[model samples]
Target: MPRLPPAPSKHPSVLGVDIGGTGMKGGIVRLGHGPKSGTLRGDRFRLDTPQPALPATMARTLAQIVSELDHREKAPDADSRVGVCFPSIVQRGVCRSANNIDPSWIGVSLQDTFEDALQRPVTVVNDADAAGLAEARYGAGAGVPGLVMVITLGTGIGGAMINDGVLVPNFEVGSLELDGVMAESRASAKAREREGLDWPEYALRLQRFFSHLERIFSPDLFIVGGGISKRPHDYLPLLQLETPIVPAMLQNNAGIVGAALAAHADPADGLLR
Candidate 1:
């Protein structure tokens, strides 16, 4: 008989980190019991991220958060795992580019940095992918089958593709050239700021953008997420498209919950670092 590879290590609990442009949000998630369909609040915290934040600073902050979570009897100390939502194009185990951090972060192994600081396992995934997974599992895409595409229209338009409940990361549709300009530059929250438009106008542009996306991906389900998702009914009605569209059920909690779910799903991988 052929020999099998050694079994991978596993952890009992996870520290879910959602790294954003303005703040770093996280929580200690035990294997069971958390927000179901975006109820929110299950041991979470948010802290402002420093400008040009060094990888070392990120690691230190992560360590502090995880250490506190570990101190609680409810979560594992030595065996706790960490999952991060990084705003960047992640390739293999390195960050290709960071949207919310210093350019020096390019080519850095964020997983390695966090692991070295906390002496635990760690996994770093694109922020959009994390949020998409959450939506697919417990939010808008729940029970829906086949292709599901989620677009987060915040500072930048972030995207994640889920087919059969799996995440296809690093799909920067936002950067695609539309009419000789970056789509995100004209369609994202940045555009709202640049154009001095409100949600209604922004939603109208979103409708036009989604129309293009529908033509390309032809997703069976499309979800709009991000902070703006909180009032999706208000703007979602304005955005017209061919496919079925809905607001993400998890809203703000989607990222953290999804990060935890990502770590928990890959049980054999131990910590992401």
Candidate 2:
């Protein structure tokens, strides 16, 4: 497996953005950039994504975040790049679906939205993919190779594949149909919430969910994350599985940081069409 190079000290810090259904989050990250240039200093915070979030509303939110961060840069000469991780399927730069957000978000050109508003290069990616990238690079899958699958169990099941070192985002394993029903229909924490089953019951189903993922991805390492991952002690012990699974090292902050990292990597600013 190819190795991801360390973040060099000479490089400037990359700005990371994480977009969610109700809120947007971000932070400046240094990656491996050294003690000063790439150091992450602030906490992740939220801004409402607006009810019935249309392209305009979302764009406004992004512009505000970048504008604020850009002011914080010590050297006005160093232009910062923006990375945005969206909670929807992002192909090229277009958000194909707004599963977790307002229906107005469908077909939104996320990259253009950010760039047009902020005038900074913007890279757009799936939120899960961003989280997965963080896990692969600095968290659970660090230094390990072959096949690494980062699975985020949140409102839905998010799967991202990293082969050698490249990221394959928005795998959408949750939407897969199983026995004439959707997999997430039974396995998601949301599903359990509706069913009124306890965590143990949910965990039993989660075991089956992970087993299915194990068979499909055949990942050498599994990094499980999401809000639920915060309580690994609660039900992870009840989960039965084959492949080795570990808690996502970065936890909830992975998506925000990964999105920022994406901005640093994409030359054209990772704009979607």
Candidate 3:
């Protein structure tokens, strides 16, 4: 393979976009050298995810987001490079599976599509993996040693596994089977809403899920993310397990900041390899 470019320094700003089932959000991120280093330069810009969400349509929308966010006045040092996190299983820039996205996304090259649309250098990663990286380096999991698993309990369960600070990309723990069904089907935030579950009832599902994970990897820490993470006290205390679990500090912004980190850092620099 050809050599990759050297990682950018901590001072420059990079554009980060997070594509999800409901919305696409973007912002310019300024990176620093310590924990919670990624900060948005301006208000986050959001657009509804288009119906059908086809590659061509979404690419156009993505380009629009890039155009709106990559302004010289707001981010003078920002270059024509972008990092994107998508709701899919991305490996080496290719999307292997679609999550809450059109089935046409499977087998597509996420990096190339965005790069072609925006005419910029792009880094693409799985949304959950991006969140996990952010949490591991700059959020709740920061300074923690050994294995850390970041789990986002959103519309679906998304997982990322980090050892020390290096990411073991595409961990996909959400797919694990529990009670004869995919774990997310019963344990995810969407499932809670769909089933009209109270906080304690939801905790029961989460307890089962976490217990299952404990029996397997036995991670050093578990960082819970997603919209639900903002209200962690409601359900987190009810789960009984040997492992320590905490809410993600970055919460909804983790993917955006993590995408920026991926864009500015080289894959070999304690990121994905």
Task: State the C-alpha lDDT per candidate.
Answer: 0.73, 0.73, 0.84
TM-score of each: 0.86, 0.87, 0.93
Lowest summed lDDT window (length 10), candidate 3: 1-10
Candidates 2 and 3 compared by lDDT, better number: 3
Task: After the best TM-score superposition of candidate 2, give how far the Cα of residue 198 lies from its true spot, in angstroms.
Answer: 1.5
Question: Model 2: what TM-score?
Answer: 0.87
Residue-by-residue lDDT tens digits, candidate 1, 17-62: 8888778888765434333323333567777776668888777777
Clashing pairs in 1: 121-271, 121-272, 122-271, 122-272, 122-273, 123-272
What are the runs in model 3 whose C-alpha is more than 4 Å off?
1-9, 34-36, 76-79, 267-270
The best candidate in terms of TM-score: 3
Compose the digit string of candidate 3's lDDT tens values, residues 57-133.
99999988888886646663434678899998887889898768899989998888988898878898789988987
RMSD per candidate (Å) reads 4.8, 3.2, 2.8
lDDT of 2 by residue, 36-142 (tens): 43335566656887777778878888777766666674322235567789888988788887667777767878788778887767788888888877777667886
Quote model 3's TM-score.
Answer: 0.93
Residue 162 local lDDT, model 1: 79
lDDT of residue 266 for candidate 1? 48
Worst 10 residues of 2 by lDDT: 264-273
Which pairs clash in the backbone of model 3? Answer: none
Q: Name the lDDT of candidate 2.
A: 0.73
By TM-score rank, best first, the candidates go: 3, 2, 1
